[model samples]
Target: MSKRINSPDTEADITLRTYLDIYPHVCFNMIAGAGSGKTTSLIKALSHIVQNHGAKLKMRGQHVACITYTEIAAREIWDDVGNSPLIDVSTIHSFLWKIIRPFQKDIKDWVIERVGEKIKEREERINRSGTRATTKEKLRKEINKLNRQANAVEKVPFFNYGTGSSYDNGILGHDDIIKMAVSYLNSSEVLRKIIGQKYPYIFVDESQDTFPEIVEALSLVRITNGDRFCLGFFGDPMQKIYPSGIGDLPGDREWKIIKKPENFRCSKEVLDVINNIRRTGDGLEQTQGNKTVGSARIFVLPLVDEQQRTEYLRKVQEKCVSISDDQLWLADGHVKILVLVHRMAAKRLKFPKLFAAMNDNAPLSFKNGLTDGSAWPLAFFLKFVLPLATTKLKGDNTMVMRMLRAHSPRLNKEQLKGTEVRQALEQLKVGLDMLVKQLGDGSQSTVLDVLNTLKNTDMVKLDERLIRYMEGNAEETDELEDDEEGKEALSMQNFFAVPAVEFWGYLKYYNNQSPFATQQGVKGAQFDRVITILDDDEGKHAQFSYDKYFGLKELSTDDSKNVKEGKDYVIPRTRRLFYVSCSRAKKHLVVIYYTADVEKAIMNIKRMKIFPEEQIFKVEDLN
Candidate 1:
């Protein structure tokens, strides 16, 4: 076991020390600010527990449950602390699946009932589409497939279709599992007791962003049995960016709330602007000090004429380039462009072109993105697996190759210098083309047939990561992930029966043409210099109004403010979105307003003294 962590630099660190000193008796909440050292603080807390009380907990058969917000966060914590049986670190889905998996019969029944309702509704819709010659055959096939799925539920009694699979695979789409777990715990007193006996400490990271149902269920467990375990919640209320935030989460007078209000990521200059805009920025200090001097600037662009708008765009591009060349910045400066809308990054900022330029000419290349640890696997499915599994005559080899080069560290341009690997990929491409012909149109071949054909070929390297992508870990595989899972013990026919369009939709989500990302996409990520573009012309901004935050407008007396005080808030999603974007920058932040009356808003903000005079700029000045 590691030694108890001992680093007390700030008041927050001291607060953490005080909480952990009491150990298993206190139910505490850590209220952190944006850019604060929450991750570091969490690591310290975990380390203290592991080094000091881990052995005792293990002796008692009670372990710590550290629940993170996402898989990436879980992996990060696991990497930092190293894997330990005394502690269980995982996302909410993974953690819940373990607790709920034992009650598969109850869950399966619940899932089947839900699926049956959906299938019935779909059948009605298909029938309503009319029996036209063009649509009749397709509708008939769909109905048959749904009927087959419905029938399979009885044969495969322990199945879950909610996770894009025939059974719960301990990965993806955990909403159903969470609901079922809540229901099961509410009904079964024995199961709750069993859980309480096993886990003595429950730590929820990013608790502000936790789902309402999950929070409610956890609170139910605590309230029902108050003396069971110590539950610790840690997150910033300002950072609650999701739809169902911790506003409805269970908390009362007994739970002690501690504040960690130090800005470790940003400088005082950046914090000044942030403090001015933030609703609860009292006593928030930048701990970075003289370490990193950061700058914040707001640019108001002209929208009167086409010529002025064109010039404004030109200046913005120049500034982006200049920011890249600036010495004070760190990392790839070009990667720092943030947009209000995903489309704005592609349309106004030309992010696709920027990425293409970077990949074509830069010293380094961008990596292929992943969503829920399934990017490369899905890409592999689309490229090699799908065509072989389905009756599709042709495959997009170019797109497949692009995904390969982007994501795989071993399959880059540098690695392609050798003729052997290049020839192998080319041979594999040829093998894929020929296999489509061998399978033929309407050929009755399973996914295993494709695997069998390519298993021994010289084109496929046994040691390559592609194998992992093609064949995921059997322990973690479900019906969608591994079609052959159905055939193993259930004796089900055509277990991997995903529709072509349905599969494509999953793949298309991660494989976007542009490099520009949304606020939600770039959370928990930091950049050297961030240039955020604000515009609502695409109609993607929804009901989020920037005018109120920018000081141009006030909260109308008639309008109901959703924001809650202290514990949680029901404020505009736009406020959280802006906070997320602004907090990402380490050294420099440039926010561009692309509205018609941009000058008025800028003047209003200046009058309010939200931004210093030197930090505000006009687009015309840049030109």
Candidate 2:
């Protein structure tokens, strides 16, 4: 039942096999490029262990712990394990939560007692007696704004009930899961023995992106558990796209590093381009064969001022249309576009225009109870707002009911006035309390069904023609799929039409907006095509030195510094940033520039050799 496929006859295969041969007792690193079947190899290795070594291993019912960065990636790996009899895979965070949940009371008590004094101080500062409403509002707004800003920049919300303030606290986010696990291993020899007896093998995927903390944790496990556990770390340093990625190869005691120099996801031409960028004196050769099925071209755009940036965006839209008509169109119409700004200033300036363009072209459409924007807001609300509201309402069901009534037209105009809203909200509160109590007693589903049946009596369908005209002629479809248990978790009908409490949960907990405000928000995410609009300011050049502006102070040294100081300092970073942006496009790259700055951008483009001089264009020349 293993879903793993055999490795193809290539350098990648040879490299993977070498690691598996020495695995279990030994630690080996397989640095394979993106789309190089690293996950496939891990699955195959796990299958081998399960089928051949399960009895010999006698792993005390311990499952293979496969750690990944995202929930989506973890699910993908779980699928790859494919109904395997022996293997167990999960995200590191989920795995830690499972292990720690048993000791939750002790852990919670310890953390709360330790951090109690700090929390008390903060609460007292804001909730002083006789405080003016304006003062309280200002403080609350400040707290909310700071929390939002932190979420945007760090992808970490202000509060983590598990670890306190994520901002001031030095707690690791996802990576800390492994760190905590390692701490448990070190603290309890019995726990280590239990884990060692249960799961004999550990596979860490995407090792290149792993942090030093995770690496250290794994090392501790190996040292403490002796030879009972086997570790396999797989990743490619060249594909270390994350800023804090630990690109170290395996070395020294109990560690072996193996190179996987294969170009399976790109054609020879594409490999050539990749090699040129990665070329150092290291003599790392690019492997050919297993070529990708498409062609790739890099482009550069010149923008002398804001006017030029606008025109460039227009050109990008035109290119998207062309690419859609020709090649690289997907069923979902999700184009992976990357707009790389060279400096912090450029990102600040250009990102707004870029976002506006995307919004103008693809206005966000949300479910009725959800926020008007994307799903991310709903996810946030579910995580923070729902619990707080539930606690405040004190078993009242009226919160959700009032929202439903507001949207419903069952009541007459006068009846829909202020007092009615308040009374209806009160009813909703009571109803929610009853629903929660019934659910706690295992009658919640029955109550939910009864409530839905009653609410449907007043349901009315509005004319679709007007909605279509106002929101564009887009087809409506259910967003959630039916699970095997037949439990309706989320549905378009309930989510889009019914203003239920469940809908609020869907909006608050499922939103996936980009964490950063500008281009950084879209980092690590890909689009089909990209259009970049450069700001027409002195700071525009800073976009090229992303490391400097984005707090990568370590990388923004020497040459990057000189580039910032020199007259043409901006050109190199700008051109490089543009290349990074354009390279993110899977199919097409379009550049737009002002008629005046066309020559300057073209000269930089020619110098960088992104495209031939003939391809460079001016605004007037386009027609």
Candidate 3:
């Protein structure tokens, strides 16, 4: 159940209502902290528009555009609005794609040019490797394959780009779409005017996550028309976790500030803990006065002796288990143990890994696993595609068919039942093995080479739809234009040139059941209790550091220097990530840090009263 509720209008709510009533004439930036009812306020503003200004909007053929940061957010807005055509709710990517897809000819031309450039770059690399007979043969072989792949005279109608799993997606990668959208809006006045007229009132939720370029594009429309269009920027600067983020408010122009400091999620006690971490907190208030006061502590997990550290972690885990007892909170979900790390593959945490084992092989696994918490496409790839592709193992016909059926939307069940399809797959696997073998003994092979061999195979008739899988094309999203046969195949070909082993290794790395989740993945989610494991590990993105947030070090200077000069400066991203992790708990928040000078840092922090001494515990002390 949600901790927040629809109550009487607060000071922030009244201000938002007043500002939105005068929208298009008055631009406002709602600086809402975590769990400040930003979504509810957004919904309320839209509901207001639907009730009061619906007729005017309907007559003018315009709608209020609410652009969210994620698909989940978009859905929540949709559910709240309940099938209102006057309300345009979509993720920034979806909204931007809708605007840019119409100008797809330009995008198509751009993709072909990019592909051509890649081919040229590959050729140059091959040339530079060596002039040996083997090198020449390899180069010639690769060039011929490239020529065959690039043989089509016509344009690429649909190309897969973004990292998402929507099939044969339309032209332009998500980044490209944003860039192209910015370019198109800059050059085309009529289109911008049309868009401005279409969505005169624009509300951007979680505006901090939006790329500056994308924001500028939308801002351009509003700027060109001059107050004829209104854009409400709603987000918390403290929660700006993305590295590329430029903070929540619009950089293009100034606006009236509206602060929503009432945190409806966590209790005042929890807020106090969050506030202490960031000196700039807005002193947010809890929604319910009777809400339970959650415990917040910082545990210093010292890495004293290399061997003893393992035992220390075991004790720490056991203590965490006791702290996260199920009887303590009424929340239904399992306690989330958040491990802050530089990289999932680079840093090792045992708890989450222990539970990673699951047989994702059955036919219904992909579908069921989605509801049960596995990423659909990745799970499908791991269970079906990767296993079969890596080995010459047979009798996995259903897995191939299921994967092909999923990725290739046009492939019917009857198509999978065909004996020719099975024979082709069997032959394809054999051919793949031979290709890998030929590249033998210290020779490296690219993902593209493997995919290309499948594309060129002759044993079984290949469906153009299933060709993407054979080709290791992941970007073939659902937005791709259908061929004369009305079929689409989304491919991840951009990942093709990557070394096959490395690609598989990354997947193997991802195929884990660790209870620990990166702070970014679980930011919006709430847990009964959260155990955040912080460490200063090498290869971790320097942007997120616990030392800076814990008041052990300054947030600026070194981190800022590292970013600007590309030197060994502290990571600035850690600030927001730490802030986000601290705020994710509804009941208890435990921060465990492993630092180099742990004893000194702990002593300094305790002396400075950074955290309550009673709440702070040493790893050994817990035992």
Candidate number achieving the greatest TM-score relative to the actual structure: 3
| Model 3 alpha-carbon miss at residue 152, Å | 3.9
TM-score of 2: 0.56
Give the alpha carbon lDDT tens digit for every residue of 254-278 in model 3: 5778877677677666777666655
Question: Could you say which candidate leads in lDDT?
Answer: 3
| Tens digits of per-residue lDDT for model 2, 26-97 | 766766543345677677767666666666655456666677755666777777667565666765556665
Off by over 4 Å in 3: 1-8, 109-153, 157-170, 248-254, 280-290, 304-314, 320-333, 342-514, 548-572
lDDT for predicted candidate 1 compared with the true structure: 0.58
* TM-score of each prediction: 0.69, 0.56, 0.70
* C-alpha RMSD for every candidate: 10.8, 14.4, 9.4
Write down the lDDT of every candidate, Cα atoms only.
Answer: 0.58, 0.46, 0.60
lDDT of 3 at 355: 20
Q: Give the Å error, residue 376, model 1.
A: 9.4
Off by over 4 Å in 2: 1-9, 18-24, 57-59, 113-189, 280-283, 290-294, 304-310, 316-335, 340-377, 380-623
